[model samples]
Target: MQLDATDLKILQQLQADGRISNQELADKVFLSPSSCLRRVRMLEEAGIIHHYCAVIDAAAVGLEVDAFVQVTMRRDVEQWHENFSQALQQWPEVIGSYIITGDANYLLRVRARNLKHYSTFVLERLYKTTGVLDIRSNIVLQTLKDTQQIATSLLVAE
Candidate 1:
């Protein structure tokens, strides 16, 4: 809905720390706790605040490798798209998937334990999926920056 300066502030604070208590969030936004909670609830109701989750370290949790996979569909059919999308939803290795432009029809962010595991996933699972024409993967050498935070600059004019 209509987000004012205070709403933007609330969003920025929450983006930084989703675990912040309602009272703490209110203090940061300089609003009463009840008022701040109401705004948060409203944001959630309006779909601006989707869900809060913990961000875990992939490497620490046995997912040491990050891969960007480009998938090309065999046919430009509606059924093919639907089937592939559903398949991706069930696959745990895929953290993010986008129907993109350019040569590749879909781009997937995947995590694996190592290169051998990634190879097995590619050869056994992704390649065997229906309507998969070609699959290209780019392994991340070094991750400079990775965060789920939404840019607040878009909501504010400089």
Candidate 2:
């Protein structure tokens, strides 16, 4: 899946504004509308463009409390890791989770209406999860930045 300068420019523009029209995109990338559409389709077929989504404000939706929970496991085993990941994906409140190179086995992002709601989640579910040796939660004071974008500037260098 090698991308030319035009492809890179198209991707960069789309990443900046996904809603940009095909005509606008083609003009920006210096391609015909049909050619641009074909390239976009090719990117999708190559799995380079995974998915499109709208970013929503958690606070605006009434889930005001943003939290990070660090869980230390009894041990890291393939079976335990697989089971944990499977169980994790089923829990909707567990917005995002990561396996990190740190003391904690996994870091989790959780959203709730408030501290009381978060506490209930911690006690009932997070505490009850199997193979969890310890847990520490940090409530967010404020969010400075959060984005799913990757830098497109590296494409040319690569």
Candidate 3:
């Protein structure tokens, strides 16, 4: 859908606070409650607004270790890429995974309770996975910024 300035304003408000009431959202966006609801529904139907989720703090839930794992696959193994992708879905420790242009075939963001827990995952699970050639891991020391919000201001330019 082609979004106007009003649509952009609505998106900006929603991105900042997903839980905002329709009445409050309407007030902020200068639309009536029904109009705001209709526009939001349209956005959802268009797949612009994918879904809502709560961002949980990993440390608060006893997850302290965060590591970026670079995995290189054995090129000779049949269906190695597909098998590795499937394996990632089964491992809860792997919070995020991506195929990237680099020395590694895949990059994985893994979270664990501690160093021992992280080590166990690397040794028992990741190492044992078939077609895995080389594994490199860099533990995150600190997180400076973490956000899922998109800059609606930039989108308005398009």
Candidate 4:
């Protein structure tokens, strides 16, 4: 969809607070509640707005450490990629995975209770997963910034 200023405004507002009522959204965008509702629905149908989700704190649930693991495979075969993706998808501990641009074939973000838990993940779970030839990791010392929102300034530029 061709997102104009109004669409971008709606998206920016929604990005800040998805739980915002249509009535409040209408006020922000200078649209009627019904119009805001219609626009949001249209954005969803057009795939401009993909989905909404809650961001949870890992430390609150016995997850004390965050890890970034870089995995390299022997080969970039389709079956190998599929097998790895499927395996990671089934493991809830593997919070996020990306086929990224770098020396590593895949990048994974994992949260564990502690170093011992991470050892189990690497030695037991990760080693057991198929097609993993080499793995490297950098433990997150501190999180300076984290966000789920895409910058409106970037996305709205035409």
lDDT of 1 by residue, 70-108 (tens): 999989566999999998898889999999999999999
Candidate 4 regions exceeding 4 Å error are 76-78
lDDT of 3 by residue, 1-158 (tens): 89988888988898889999999999999999999999999999999999998889999999999999999999999999999999989999999999989899999999999999999999999999999999999999999987888888778663
Tell me the TM-score of each prediction against the true structure: 0.95, 0.91, 0.95, 0.92
Clash pairs (backbone) in predicted model 4: none
TM-score of 4: 0.92
- Model 1, residue pairs in steric clash: none
Error of 1 at 87 (Å): 1.2
Cα misplacement distance, residue 55 of candidate 1 (Å): 0.1
lDDT agreement of model 4 with the native: 0.89
Measured on C-alpha atoms, candidate 3 has an lDDT of 0.94
Candidate 2 Cα errors over 4 Å, as ranges: 76-78
Candidate 1, after superposition: displacement of residue 82 in Å? 1.3
- Most lDDT-accurate candidate: 3
lDDT of 2 by residue, 92-130 (tens): 789999999889999999999988999888888877877
- Stronger candidate by lDDT (3 vs 4): 3
